[model samples]
Target: MVEAMAKAKLWTSPGGKRPDATLYAAILSDMRKGKGARFKKPAPGRFMGA
Candidate 1:
Protein backbone atom coordinates (compact mmCIF):
# COMPACT_ATOMS: atom_id res chain seq x y z
CA MET A 1 0.00 0.00 0.00
CA VAL A 2 2.76 2.42 0.91
CA GLU A 3 4.68 1.61 -2.24
CA ALA A 4 1.59 2.18 -4.36
CA MET A 5 0.91 5.48 -2.69
CA ALA A 6 4.50 6.61 -3.03
CA LYS A 7 4.66 5.66 -6.71
CA ALA A 8 1.51 7.60 -7.55
CA LYS A 9 2.25 10.76 -9.53
CA LEU A 10 -0.62 12.68 -7.98
CA TRP A 11 -3.35 12.46 -5.40
CA THR A 12 -6.78 13.09 -6.86
CA SER A 13 -8.73 15.57 -4.79
CA PRO A 14 -11.77 17.80 -5.09
CA GLY A 15 -9.34 20.65 -5.64
CA GLY A 16 -7.59 18.49 -8.28
CA LYS A 17 -4.18 16.84 -8.02
CA ARG A 18 -2.69 17.77 -4.64
CA PRO A 19 1.03 17.79 -4.06
CA ASP A 20 0.40 17.90 -0.31
CA ALA A 21 -1.15 14.45 -0.42
CA THR A 22 1.73 13.18 -2.49
CA LEU A 23 4.17 14.53 0.04
CA TYR A 24 2.25 12.96 2.89
CA ALA A 25 2.11 9.65 1.02
CA ALA A 26 5.84 9.76 0.52
CA ILE A 27 6.42 10.41 4.19
CA LEU A 28 4.11 7.58 5.14
CA SER A 29 5.87 5.31 2.72
CA ASP A 30 9.21 6.10 4.25
CA MET A 31 7.87 5.56 7.75
CA ARG A 32 6.36 2.24 6.72
CA LYS A 33 9.73 1.15 5.43
CA GLY A 34 11.30 2.13 8.82
CA LYS A 35 13.38 4.88 7.26
CA GLY A 36 11.92 7.73 9.33
CA ALA A 37 13.89 8.09 12.51
CA ARG A 38 12.98 11.69 13.31
CA PHE A 39 9.66 10.50 14.65
CA LYS A 40 9.75 7.93 17.41
CA LYS A 41 7.04 6.05 19.26
CA PRO A 42 6.42 7.56 22.66
CA ALA A 43 7.51 5.53 25.67
CA PRO A 44 4.84 3.57 27.42
CA GLY A 45 2.92 5.47 30.15
CA ARG A 46 3.89 8.82 28.68
CA PHE A 47 0.44 9.46 27.26
CA MET A 48 -2.57 10.64 29.28
CA GLY A 49 -4.48 7.41 28.72
CA ALA A 50 -1.57 5.32 29.85
Candidate 2:
Protein backbone atom coordinates (compact mmCIF):
# COMPACT_ATOMS: atom_id res chain seq x y z
CA MET A 1 0.00 0.00 0.00
CA VAL A 2 2.68 2.42 0.98
CA GLU A 3 4.72 1.59 -2.05
CA ALA A 4 1.78 2.16 -4.35
CA MET A 5 0.95 5.51 -2.84
CA ALA A 6 4.59 6.50 -2.96
CA LYS A 7 4.50 6.06 -6.69
CA ALA A 8 1.88 8.78 -6.88
CA LYS A 9 3.03 12.39 -6.95
CA LEU A 10 2.87 14.82 -4.03
CA TRP A 11 1.25 18.23 -4.13
CA THR A 12 2.44 21.56 -2.77
CA SER A 13 0.94 24.99 -2.49
CA PRO A 14 2.05 27.16 -5.36
CA GLY A 15 1.48 30.35 -3.36
CA GLY A 16 3.67 29.02 -0.60
CA LYS A 17 7.11 30.41 -0.04
CA ARG A 18 9.86 28.87 -2.09
CA PRO A 19 10.57 25.49 -0.54
CA ASP A 20 13.83 23.58 -0.41
CA ALA A 21 13.85 21.02 -3.18
CA THR A 22 15.27 18.30 -0.96
CA LEU A 23 12.78 19.01 1.81
CA TYR A 24 9.91 18.91 -0.62
CA ALA A 25 11.13 15.64 -1.99
CA ALA A 26 11.31 14.18 1.48
CA ILE A 27 7.83 15.35 2.33
CA LEU A 28 6.48 13.88 -0.88
CA SER A 29 8.19 10.64 -0.05
CA ASP A 30 6.53 10.58 3.35
CA MET A 31 3.11 11.43 2.00
CA ARG A 32 3.41 8.72 -0.58
CA LYS A 33 3.90 6.33 2.34
CA GLY A 34 0.45 7.34 3.64
CA LYS A 35 1.76 9.97 6.02
CA GLY A 36 -0.41 13.06 6.23
CA ALA A 37 0.38 16.06 4.11
CA ARG A 38 2.66 18.70 5.60
CA PHE A 39 1.17 22.10 6.18
CA LYS A 40 3.38 25.13 5.78
CA LYS A 41 3.21 28.09 8.10
CA PRO A 42 1.61 31.25 6.75
CA ALA A 43 3.88 33.45 4.75
CA PRO A 44 5.90 35.80 6.91
CA GLY A 45 4.61 39.37 7.39
CA ARG A 46 1.37 38.40 5.67
CA PHE A 47 -0.79 39.82 8.42
CA MET A 48 1.63 42.00 10.29
CA GLY A 49 -0.03 44.64 12.56
CA ALA A 50 -3.38 43.08 11.93
Candidate 3:
Protein backbone atom coordinates (compact mmCIF):
# COMPACT_ATOMS: atom_id res chain seq x y z
CA MET A 1 0.00 0.00 0.00
CA VAL A 2 2.58 2.51 1.11
CA GLU A 3 4.87 1.36 -1.69
CA ALA A 4 2.26 2.10 -4.36
CA MET A 5 1.35 5.47 -2.86
CA ALA A 6 5.01 6.44 -2.55
CA LYS A 7 5.63 5.47 -6.16
CA ALA A 8 2.62 7.57 -7.18
CA LYS A 9 4.09 10.57 -5.33
CA LEU A 10 1.05 11.04 -3.15
CA TRP A 11 2.56 13.34 -0.54
CA THR A 12 4.20 16.51 -1.72
CA SER A 13 5.53 17.78 1.64
CA PRO A 14 6.85 15.82 4.66
CA GLY A 15 8.69 13.78 2.09
CA GLY A 16 11.18 10.87 2.49
CA LYS A 17 10.60 7.77 4.64
CA ARG A 18 7.78 9.53 6.54
CA PRO A 19 5.23 8.00 4.17
CA ASP A 20 5.47 4.76 6.14
CA ALA A 21 2.94 6.14 8.65
CA THR A 22 1.80 9.58 7.54
CA LEU A 23 0.30 7.98 4.48
CA TYR A 24 -1.93 5.76 6.56
CA ALA A 25 -3.07 8.68 8.69
CA ALA A 26 -3.93 10.65 5.60
CA ILE A 27 -5.76 7.71 4.06
CA LEU A 28 -7.68 7.00 7.28
CA SER A 29 -8.74 10.62 7.46
CA ASP A 30 -10.37 10.32 4.06
CA MET A 31 -12.24 7.24 5.24
CA ARG A 32 -14.00 9.46 7.79
CA LYS A 33 -15.32 11.71 5.04
CA GLY A 34 -18.49 9.66 4.71
CA LYS A 35 -19.61 9.39 1.08
CA GLY A 36 -16.83 11.62 -0.18
CA ALA A 37 -14.04 9.38 1.02
CA ARG A 38 -11.00 8.59 -1.15
CA PHE A 39 -10.33 5.13 0.29
CA LYS A 40 -11.99 2.19 1.99
CA LYS A 41 -10.73 -0.75 4.08
CA PRO A 42 -12.42 -4.00 3.23
CA ALA A 43 -10.20 -5.76 5.82
CA PRO A 44 -7.68 -4.86 8.49
CA GLY A 45 -4.37 -3.46 7.21
CA ARG A 46 -5.86 -3.35 3.75
CA PHE A 47 -6.94 -0.43 1.59
CA MET A 48 -8.72 -0.03 -1.75
CA GLY A 49 -10.20 2.78 -3.77
CA ALA A 50 -13.63 3.98 -2.74
Candidate 4:
Protein backbone atom coordinates (compact mmCIF):
# COMPACT_ATOMS: atom_id res chain seq x y z
CA MET A 1 0.00 0.00 0.00
CA VAL A 2 2.78 2.41 0.88
CA GLU A 3 4.56 1.63 -2.37
CA ALA A 4 1.38 2.08 -4.35
CA MET A 5 0.66 5.40 -2.68
CA ALA A 6 4.20 6.53 -3.19
CA LYS A 7 3.95 5.78 -6.90
CA ALA A 8 0.54 7.36 -7.47
CA LYS A 9 1.70 10.95 -7.00
CA LEU A 10 -0.96 11.23 -4.37
CA TRP A 11 1.48 12.95 -2.08
CA THR A 12 2.38 16.51 -2.90
CA SER A 13 3.90 19.55 -1.29
CA PRO A 14 4.80 23.00 -2.53
CA GLY A 15 8.42 23.82 -3.33
CA GLY A 16 10.45 24.95 -0.28
CA LYS A 17 7.69 23.58 1.93
CA ARG A 18 8.68 22.24 5.31
CA PRO A 19 7.02 18.90 4.66
CA ASP A 20 7.76 16.93 1.55
CA ALA A 21 5.17 15.06 -0.49
CA THR A 22 6.24 11.69 0.77
CA LEU A 23 5.93 12.74 4.41
CA TYR A 24 2.47 14.23 3.90
CA ALA A 25 1.30 11.18 2.04
CA ALA A 26 2.55 8.88 4.73
CA ILE A 27 0.84 10.89 7.47
CA LEU A 28 -2.41 11.06 5.53
CA SER A 29 -2.32 7.37 4.76
CA ASP A 30 -1.63 6.53 8.36
CA MET A 31 -4.48 8.75 9.53
CA ARG A 32 -6.86 7.08 7.09
CA LYS A 33 -5.80 3.59 8.10
CA GLY A 34 -6.06 4.53 11.75
CA LYS A 35 -9.60 5.82 11.33
CA GLY A 36 -10.59 2.73 9.39
CA ALA A 37 -9.57 0.52 12.32
CA ARG A 38 -10.72 2.85 15.12
CA PHE A 39 -14.02 1.09 15.48
CA LYS A 40 -14.26 -2.65 15.95
CA LYS A 41 -17.30 -4.70 16.91
CA PRO A 42 -17.02 -6.31 20.29
CA ALA A 43 -17.36 -10.03 20.70
CA PRO A 44 -20.47 -11.49 22.25
CA GLY A 45 -20.65 -10.96 26.01
CA ARG A 46 -17.49 -8.87 25.85
CA PHE A 47 -19.28 -5.66 26.78
CA MET A 48 -21.06 -4.72 29.95
CA GLY A 49 -24.40 -5.65 28.37
CA ALA A 50 -23.95 -8.16 25.65
| 1 or 2, greater by TM-score | 1
lDDT of 4: 0.44
Global lDDT of model 3: 0.80
TM-score, per-candidate, Cα-based: 0.36, 0.31, 0.72, 0.29
Candidate 3 residue lDDT tens string, 1-50? 66765578865437757666787788899999999998899999998999
Residue 33 miss distance in model 1 (angstroms): 1.5
Arrange candidates, best TM-score first: 3, 1, 2, 4
Judge candidate 2 against the unseen true structure and give its global Cα lDDT, from 0 to 1: 0.41
- Model 2 residue 8 CA deviation (Å) reads 30
Q: lDDT per model, in order?
A: 0.43, 0.41, 0.80, 0.44
**Tens digit of lDDT per residue, candidate 4, span 1-50?**
33453489754444444555555444545545644533233554221111
At residue 23, what lDDT does model 1 achieve?
A: 47
Among all candidates shown, the one with the greatest lDDT: 3
In model 2, where do residues sit more than 4 Å from their true spots? 1-19, 35-50
Instruction: Evaluate model 2: give its TM-score.
Output: 0.31
lDDT for 20 in candidate 1 is 62
Candidate 2 per-residue lDDT over residues 1-50, each given as its tens digit: 22333356443334435444544555446545433544332464221111
RMSD of 4: 11.7
Model 1 C-alpha lDDT per residue in residues 1-50, reported as the tens digit of each score: 33453469433433437656654554445445554333333554221111
